[model samples]
Target: MDAMTPPDREAPAEAPIEALLRRRWSPRSFQDRPVPDAALASLLEAARWAPSCFNAQPWHLIVARRERETEAHAALAACLSGNNRRWAPQAPVLMLAVARTTFPQDGSPNRHAGYDTGAAMAQMAAQAVVLGLQIHQMGGFDPHRAREAFAIPDGFEPYAAIAIGYPGPADALPEDLRAREQAPRQRRAVADFAFFGGWRA
Candidate 1:
């Protein structure tokens, strides 16, 4: 239940998959330990390698480590919605994922910008699992406030707010969250979505 023995929230995959993918799950309880700079660098590096359309690499991460940037971290936390503000601020790191909506070269709209940003975060999430860390990405935030707080520029959109740190006991969370945290992981069967050469309604 402590950081040394965090709960196992691995996904019950229907088919065999890499342990890294199976092991990753978002958690609201994070330990007090600060993520090391090296580990942070490695995570960003993993994200940097994610593939993107036209190799545009349109993602940008605004990171705030609680210990290192206390004020900045607080400012970022203030942008979270009430539900997220309850648990997300406990993590040692907070990040805002931003996407450049326009192609830099031509100033034209890039429809895949958000998709590519998500791919980058996916890679970062995998890296977190590898580092014995966990990340919970949240859509519950005020993007306009985040833009004002961070001075995010024009043509850039805030996609998600992320809380990252080592996992902690489910009991550390409030009663409701703890219940949800310990609940079984669920996913649709592959057959439910995958089809053979044609779409199914």
Candidate 2:
């Protein structure tokens, strides 16, 4: 992953914090514009700072820009399904988040690698919203293909790939996507998904 930082250096503040948490929502349509380099950098920077188990810092990012990095983008996006393909192209950038199991000390498996990486991704996604950007996580990619394409060695596992860009008009999206554009976020109620203490009887 290209670790590029934006020139405008300002530590992330509260607005982004709330936006990241509340305003963030996945959308199919994306404005056909290249996300500012600084914005991308800021997002990654936030991700890099996320806390990890044993400070493993296992998250790995692979970024693909539309024009400048077509080969990598295509290889990454090729793993997705047709649903994502419909409007994913409009996003200026695509990212693949990966993790390495070994921490270079012992050969033991790092159980927290995937979890830590997920934390980092959450940080990045939230920060992106603060920056007026949006992201969608996709699980439809081919792992074996991603491993070969990215030349990921034996120790590392590709966790997930994300589509990143500015939000676009829902109308511009295809009928299927457009239909769900204004749909509210669906979730099991807090009571359903959460438990007060011990496992439910």
Candidate 3:
């Protein structure tokens, strides 16, 4: 089994995170277990509270629980790249985060929709960490396939797909993934990303 104390698995941060940032870490190996409905609800509730541009709240979360939403679960699963498919399916829950590209009231372009959707997903990820679940988001999925499979409307765009569940044994993964699981997490230095008086690239 994976370590019960997930926080210990976190990479040393340049600066501390509040409430420990739930010490969140992403792992591909997930136990063959079902996420409780109550926990799932809390995750969505967390996402719902994220701030949006102009209060537009353009994110639409499409959730497919392995047990409750089988067809949807399969469709979402199918959209994953072959590598992701190997591990993501073991998670009890899968999710697609979609962004509405226009304002609901005026139909004008909402240039900030993608940013808003990201905020919502960030909130959801924090909640998952707090609840002892790890989420793995994939950009490798075919967006076109996801749109077709889910019949996503023209104005809505799929931003990311997530796999959620309890951490599983590293042995469950292929050798490459197993090595990846053990590697230290990486991030650019704060100076590289954060700037002071003026912007710096």
Each prediction's whole-model lDDT (CA): 0.91, 0.78, 0.85
TM-score of candidate 3 on Cα atoms, chains taken together: 0.94
* Candidate 1: segments with Cα more than 4 A from true spot: 1-8
| Model 1 C-alpha lDDT per residue in residues 131-150, reported as the tens digit of each score | 98888999999999999999
Worst 10 residues of 2 by lDDT: 1-10
Error of 1 at 113 (Å): 0.4
TM-score, cand. 2? 0.87
Badly placed stretches (over 4 Å) of model 3 are 1-8
Expressed as tens digits, the lDDT of each residue in 142-179 for candidate 3 is 89999999999999999999999888888889999888
Q: Give the distance in Å from residue 57's predicted Cα in candidate 3 to where it truly belongs.
A: 0.8
Q: After superposition, how far is residue 158 of candidate 2 from its true place, in Å?
A: 1.0
Select the stronger candidate by TM-score from 1 and 2: 1
Residue 96 error, candidate 1, Å = 0.2
